[model samples]
Target: MRRVVLRGFSTEGGPRPDRTALLSLGLVVLFAPLAALSLLPLLWPLRLAGVPLSLGYTVWACSAGLYGLRPVQLALARLLWPVRRPTAAERERLDLVWSRVLRRAAVSERRFRIWVVDLADVNAHCVGRDLICVTTGALAELGDRELAGVLAHELGHHLRMHTAAAAFLVWVLLPLQALALLGSGLALPFARLGRHLRRTERGFGARRWALIAAGRLEAGLRLAFAAPGVVAFAVKNAAGREAEYQVDAYAVDLGFGAELLSALRWFEACAAPAAVAPLVPGPRRARHAAAREARPTHPPLERRMAAIIARLDAAPAAVPPQGRGRGRSESSRTLLP
Candidate 1:
């Protein structure tokens, strides 16, 4: 068995970028120009203020979380997403768990920030490289050890730079994603308009037909151009499944395998009844059309649990979390305040 190191920690040299991280970055490079098109409007105001700008630099800056703009990133996440700074009670609970996690990982508390996402589901996620968002439900629902496992899993993503690559990737694709959203929003309205015009014109107008043909041709061409990037994104998401397993391994290495395993079982218990509960009568396809077992970025639950169990079973008895206490290594504390 490979000996575990708490300080650096990982599959290899101290959680460097893996294949998933690189692929996310590769997609960013491929889509940078197209994404730049979406940022022009936002930058126009700055240009009016005589700020020097280049599309290349602006694209890079945004993808890199605008470099030194951590405050802006946090603010945008609060405004646009279901996240916020933790309240006193939430922070008290959150920090207690986080201190243990940080203590185990041998990392400074100041390096990472945690946020509370006001959600009911027992869940959490890593955003970019520095932010960890935990759902309020998770705080209320999980025990301290269970919550630590979740945090450790997310911290693994940061250690490997997975979140860094992913956040920037999403930002890079924002323009295309926004366009896709816009098209869907306009689709029904345009269809209604077309039907209305068809009814008024008694169904045959050369100009209308010409307009429809032009629109279809333009849409087809755009789709054709977008196909490659879409394929790349799918590949990146596929890579994300492997990352889930890798971080699971990280949690295990930190002696939180049992804790993480318990957390997973807790989730399974909560979700079991819902998975099998009766739904409205419908065709099999229709009933399952909207249901999903897991996200594209996660491995199946059974597989993740199995992986964690195997790691825990194989872990050496001398490992801190296995048979030893948190004080197994005094070195972990040497770096802490």
Candidate 2:
């Protein structure tokens, strides 16, 4: 029955689904706190036994709950994360571009707002509501029309409510990172014991290993206290990737998927080689590095470009009206897939 409901929810298009948003919020409300509570168990033994509760675990739990709040905060921040201390002129420029994009898109307040940051990274993102973020590097590298293509893609995310879902997952992921660090050496043993205990508790062997792992990890003393958090995080991130694809479909629907793909290829071809691991020394640092390598705010350019190409080919075209003069010529040029 639950699977059926989720399957129905996955059939997305048209205006946004209120039930889906509520369902997601419900899950965050129901599970995030429980996941946070489970973190306490990982440290139970530390208080009773000699081992201390790694600071990472505490931070992880807090982050899980905090994740529920980020979309709202991010909406409030409004293109603030990658930027710091914008000069008056810089702010004005961002405003001009943002206003132009919003006006062109005909986006309503219910849809999203465009925000530009000063970061050098070539990335753009949108969280819940109409809050969209584009970096300085992204704006500088791409032409105005090409950048509009990027903005269109981000608007696709807003149309899909990807931000709301992402907000709920952030905190849950933090604890998982802590778990990966804490259970590095003992992960296997704790997983084995956790599985057996779960099977025994249910009176029959049920295949809910993931939940069991989370429960064990939260239980604090289960030896693999961080196991559930790590496992759950991976699952969530995988889901996050799927959401990106859905947004890609929306981008195509908005008449810019192909252009977005070309832009992505251009970005990837020019980007500096990003390191796979962090050089920082700390418990959570390794997990941070791993996550960065996994998804540096957005998926790798190659994969994203390929996905966009695939989506564009799979769907019918919906080209927007070309601008006047030389810019129109550039837009008309066929970009090789």
Candidate 3:
């Protein structure tokens, strides 16, 4: 671990941006203009070289949110999202685990708000700058050690600015998401009409025209509204996966490799029953495999576990820190896999 500083927070063993986090910021820059173009109808023509006031404002807001201004944090994290709050029992456990994790990293517990997600799957995530959410299932399933590892991974995202940059990218691209939804949805009716015309055999020329028109319309709408996101995902998801690996490295460096590896085993166990099920009968399996290959958001679970094992194998033996965090005995450490 090296000394690093981020958004007014500095620590000896803190988060730093890796290639993936940089790539996320790059995507935010690349897509912001396209999103502005899509939202042009919302604003009348104005100054700033065909860019509207709204786009400028969006840039400002995104920048502010990225650096983690308190007001922006409150607005973006508190009001805009209907995130589930932790129950009393859940909070008690979360607080104890969280304090240890943050303490080890030298991050302020005050800097982040812990929330609970009402999900059955074991997962945790960070968003914007200061929010770390763990699923209810995770709270139920993971003991303090395993939960600490998961939380460490998310805290790494915050320190590296992964979630903050991702939030900016998502916010700036909202217009494009909206456009895709509206334009692509309208194509279904036209598609049905074209099919109806083909069945009626309405004069060969007219039927041909109907097919051509509807097909072109659907294709154009898809290209214009829906395709950019796919292209962007193709460009960015690689980096996103790499960022996960980097955070895994961070967790290892921060002394949670063993704990995190155990957590991954739990995830693997949870998924085993489903992975062993018979494949859906058809070429669909091949198509789905191809799709997963084309754009996987996270590295495969096995790959992550392998990487963690490799890190743990190569790491030096754990040396006690200057302070005994939470006054736990050295025998109970979660450093090695």
Q: Candidate 2, after superposition: displacement of residue 21 in Å?
A: 7.0
- Best-to-worst lDDT order: 1, 3, 2
lDDT of candidate model 2 versus the reference = 0.51
| C-alpha positional error of residue 188 in candidate 3 after TM-score superposition, expressed in Å | 4.7
Off by over 4 Å in 1: 1-15, 33-68, 178-222, 225-229, 272-292, 314-337
TM-score for each prediction? 0.67, 0.57, 0.72
What would the TM-score be for candidate 2 when compared with the true structure? 0.57
lDDT of each: 0.63, 0.51, 0.63
Q: Mind giving the per-residue lDDT tens digits that candidate 3 earns over 1-337?
A: 2221111223345456655678788888888778777766445445445866766666645664454665565455444334477888888878998898888888877878888766555667675677776766677766677778888888887888887776566666667666767677878787787678777765658778878798888778766777776666556656666667777877877877777766666555543333321211111111010011112556566666667767776442342221112234234434333
The residue-by-residue lDDT of candidate 1 on 1-337, one tens digit each, is 3332222245333446877788888878887777676556556677788875685455556446473367765765675458888999788878887998888887888988998877666678766568888877777766666678888888888888887787677666666655544454545455555566555653557757855765575566556545544655666667677678778888888877777776676676554333432211111211110112555566567677666766676442322321112322233221111
Best of the candidates, lDDT: 1
- State the lDDT of candidate 2 residue by residue for 216-331, as single tens digits: 66455433555566455445555555555555555555565655555554555556665663221122211110012336234544555555655555442343222212234355
Error of 3 at 2 (Å): 29
Ranking by TM-score: 3, 1, 2
User: What's model 3's lDDT at 268?
Assistant: 56
